[model samples]
Target chain A: MKRIFASAHVKRLFSALAALAILELMTGPPGSALTPTAGFTGSFGEASSFFGIFRTQRWVVFLFLALAMYAIWSAWLMWGTQVRAATAKAVSVPRAASRTRPVRWGMAVAVLAVALLLPHLITDPFWQAAMVEQIAVYVLLALGLNVVVGFAGLLDLGFVAFYAIGAYTTAWVTGALPTAAPFGIHFNNFYAIPIAIALAMGSGIILGAPTLRLRGDYLAIVTLGFGEIITIFANNLYGITGGSQGTNTIPHFSLHVGPIKYLWGLTPVPYYYLTIVFVILFIAGFKLLEHSRVGRAWTAIREDEVAAESVGINPLKYKVMAFAIGASTAGFAGVVTASQSNTIFPSSFTLQFSINILVLVIFGGMGSITGVVLGAIVIQTGSMYLLHTPPAGYQPQDLYIYLGALLVVMMIFRPAGLVPSRRRHREIGLAEKGEGHMNEVLTGDTP
Target chain B: MSDKIFDVDHVTLRFGGVVSLNDVTLHQERGEILAVIGPNGAGKTSLFNSLTGVYQPQEGTITFQGSDAKPMSVIGKKPHRVSAAGVARTFQASRMFSALTAFENIKIGAESHRGIGVAGAMLRGPKTRRDERTSDARTVELLDFVGLRAKANVISSSLSYGDRRRLEIARGLATGPQVLLLDEPAAGTNPSEKLELTTLIRKVRDEMGVSILLIEHDMKLVMSLAERLYVLNFGSVIAQGTPEEIRANEKVIEAYLGSTATETGDRS
Candidate 1:
């Protein structure tokens, strides 16, 4: 291969390859996937599951998939003609040359480049494991919510219902039955994961069924109610779920790659790796889905429901799919939660968890996977690290200080998020322009 | 001159004791400029609203281009669907998407025809990407046609009053409808703009091969632009003929000018 990336002409290079090289040696074997060999008994299973495959031989498989995805994405981008060519042409030299958008190519490139290097410096196994797991959970939630909010233009305040469903599914299937003590299952958590996903998707469709007729506040309230219903069931159903007391003593995740064994035996490392792998796969799946006929139909409805329906797009059909696909995230999260902690609880899947995911979606900039990932880390980590890091005797009132400040700053300085949707920002910015544009620029009714 | 595009057979719209449309019968032919002219409170816009499916008539069979156009069954259908059925309408007020630029607003209406949906805009895949590009290109062409290419990026709200009207027309045209309904193209236009708009309306009809149905109270503009005129009085068609016939009609003169017309070209 030419390896043109080595040339100086490649101005802003991602150090992902370089970081992989050094970590490759530290991880013990070449050609091994980033799947770390960590197990239960208080080790970092999630973390290893996430980065382990990258460090070991299995990385090549993941990399190949990613390369294929990128190639497909690029070819489409290169070949597809723009509908906005009129707008582009309409934008004459003077306006096109305007020096707005202070943060463009250079800054964007720097952010991406730093993302490449930042992974290497993050060597704290505990923190790495936490980061990996956290990223996986949030990204997964964001994907599901994106289908509902971003594609369907439907706001779901109680999205945690699906998450709880997945968790309960995993717990019930992998552990014992309602009749059995402590709820023991014949199948393991790994096997339960797929079933949980299916259950979550089914639950998503069930929720979507009635709610499809509603809009705005009505929809939000219904989703919220659904979330409450799921949590309440978990707390009250002691026979199966252990009630509010919850279930404990769960199993660790285990996987085999070719000749090597990467067992996430109750370690945070494997759990983290597991979460990352799933999150990436989901993102790639969504990337494809977003472009598919179904995805566009969702967005079309999202933008303008009446407009979409006029074009023979039945909004209900696509709306259900969005709900189903989005809820699938919770299923994955459920398996991870059950396997890592060897326990399950209703308290874990609450309205707060739902809101946390929603915040990540908005803060990250909806419709952008990169934005979702970044939002997940920044907002979730900020809450986990900063707000949660209470001073010795920090009371409820005292805790408000940091949160209050963060809220104020977030509202005033960055209403759109750390990285706003480029299209959204531009639309809002340009909407405010024009001295006599209404009269001379374009044609419409005189009024 | 030809068969009516819309044949409203005795539409009797009653509201308790008051009858809004009292046994009204009207016709709008294909590929011709049909102007509905009347004073305020004469149900000029109401008739239009009824035709566009915003307000369903109580009793009427309005057959449009071979099918019943105005029926309560249209109540289930949405505004966009109505627009898609070869009928595009512009609001009397500016109802453009304020968030979108003037160019974008028009493009949206234009793209609404085939590829402006979420699926079309997202994923940047082959079909959607291609559709979007074509839609955008057509939007530019439409903008240019309407002489609003210069203010394409200006938000719909930020545009001057005249430009807003132009934008609305551009947007309506973007729907690619066979029928274009203008509520009042010359309502707020100055003499120069009015003259230009008159020319534009004619060009739109002649060049685009679409039917134009206008509602204008401007007698002079109506006289010059309308090949056929329907004079409305209190939700009823009192006179229907050419400008020359309408001028000579006793009922039209009495309804509009409160006097009987003695000649075909009588003024004042």
Candidate 2:
């Protein structure tokens, strides 16, 4: 019996069973928020709405549906390898090699053109706001977190803390908060940019200096604690931070140069353009750093610290640098967000926000610039769409359930993510073959 | 000014109740091949770790004399600092950045000596570009020197065992070290590969003019390659001399071959 249970097929079946249980638990009974009504009536009825259609959730029917989906997924898992192999053999030239430089350049130009025109093309003011709020801002957050989690192989759970710091710094600088600004003089929102970035980077270094010596899990726990501490401070420090009420009169960005004066107002289009410019600048800068000596050092340290040290690469220095660099991006993002909304709330920066950005990084492809950008766009758009036209029986709380399901599916199918960095793709491929170091995938133990 | 590359004096490293290296003293002459051979738990690796600044000895001092500089102390410095001070080493088990290609692996070592900071890398200014070009050229040169130039694009993990060992040597040399410590470079290689490795080691010492300190259990390789040998047992050096002199010594034979008596069974 033990031998039978130990068989690979049996183990796979057990995993499928586990997945079914979790999915069932997450999905629950398809109804409105549960009430203690005895009768099958109103919101408590078994017949609940889905996509504007009232559907009955009989046990037998739901089970059959879940089982059918599981069966198809299993079939794909079993047959996908052969299909992929057959197609690979049929295609003589590699996919990447087939796309010549000029073609790639043309594609890039087209993408930029679309991005530049997107805000103007969308007539709805709501979507224009969403594009900047839900998508662009999150993309910046994800890109910053990617440097820590994706590039440096650090699981930083306190990433949103930096964002909070940036926002609060902006608030303080603009005299929105009760605390006096530096030199006892209030500054415009634009002047807060450099101060916020410097403070965020300084905080990152301070947090990282001693704690980065801790390996994997301990480091993660430390970062998690840091995140909690920041939130608590923001909530309790009522005199300085405005506490849970948050800072409400943070001013919008303004420019005052010789013969040129402009003030950004409530219109989201101009803010979108400004954000696009910063995002482009950051992407270009990060792309350059990714292929340079610093990037190589991070990769080396991530791969093997001892070996990196032997080769004269100081591990702690690079790790701290990663943290500071990552934090600066988040800091700038905080500035953008605080100024755009003209109000700051401690509730907006939460542990959940950090995890959400991490999800974006993982879903997009951790270390791939293009991947994370696309991931943010797709996920934010989907979530916004859901909010705009929520299905019957849907609640704001149920969004995580769908996101969890999507992540699980992604992990099972494309473990490296939607558009994995080339090295990451190769590593995952090797792990599948049981050749490369697989602990990162299986045990969450980084080398 | 002695021409000794590494000067160790009565170093002791202890972990709790156990002593890994007990009052170990050794020295390596400039531009010479030295070997330390020992059985399991003989503290050869501990001595190497101490020398490379991975472990701090509880007692004594280790001084390193570069080609033309003052004899600087190596006892308290960190590994990278020691490496920057012209000391580089490899592990008993190869620890290549498995995901990186051979060229990239070498380039990392080559670029480590000097380069621009994060801001410069992000900026991609002339200095950063020039540094990158120099490292690239150095990587190619080292690849050719180790005769892995053709396989430069191959991932380090995907290379054959012998090729990986060669790649590691190439990587160590890329650091521009005055002294290279190799830990069991011939462990997993076949006889022909071992012969190639021996030639490569000699080439490294002769052409690059780098001093070598090797740790190996392979007696033939050690005897053929090293000018002098140190035999260690129970965290202490039992014998040290020219291989010819050490080979014929009773203490050395007893330590390595054990006492030729049946009564001393466990010791043997």
Q: Give me the runs in candidate 2 sitting further than 4 Å from their true place.
A: A1-79, A89-94, A97-99, A429-447, B259-268
Quality class of the docking in candidate 1, CAPRI style = incorrect
Q: Which tens-of-lDDT digit does each residue in A117-208 have in candidate 1?
A: 54456766556555655665777788778667654657788889888777777667755435352234356667878888888988888889
Error of 1 at A155 (Å): 3.7
Compose the digit string of candidate 2's lDDT tens values, residues B1-268: 6589999999889999899988889999999999998888999888888888999999989999999888888888999989888998988888888888999999999998784488888899999999999999999999999999999999888998899999998888999999999999998989899999999999999999999999997777888899999989999999999878777778877877565422221231
Query: Which of the numbered candidates is closest to the native, going by highest lDDT?
Result: 2
Which window of 10 residues has the lowest lDDT sum in candidate 1 chain A? A437-446
Per-residue lDDT value at A424 in model 2: 70
TM-score of chain B of each: 0.88, 0.95
lDDT of 1 by residue, B130-211 (tens): 7767878988999999899888888566676677778888878887777788888787878788888888889899999778
Q: What is the C-alpha RMSD of each candidate to the true structure, in Å?
A: 16.3, 4.0
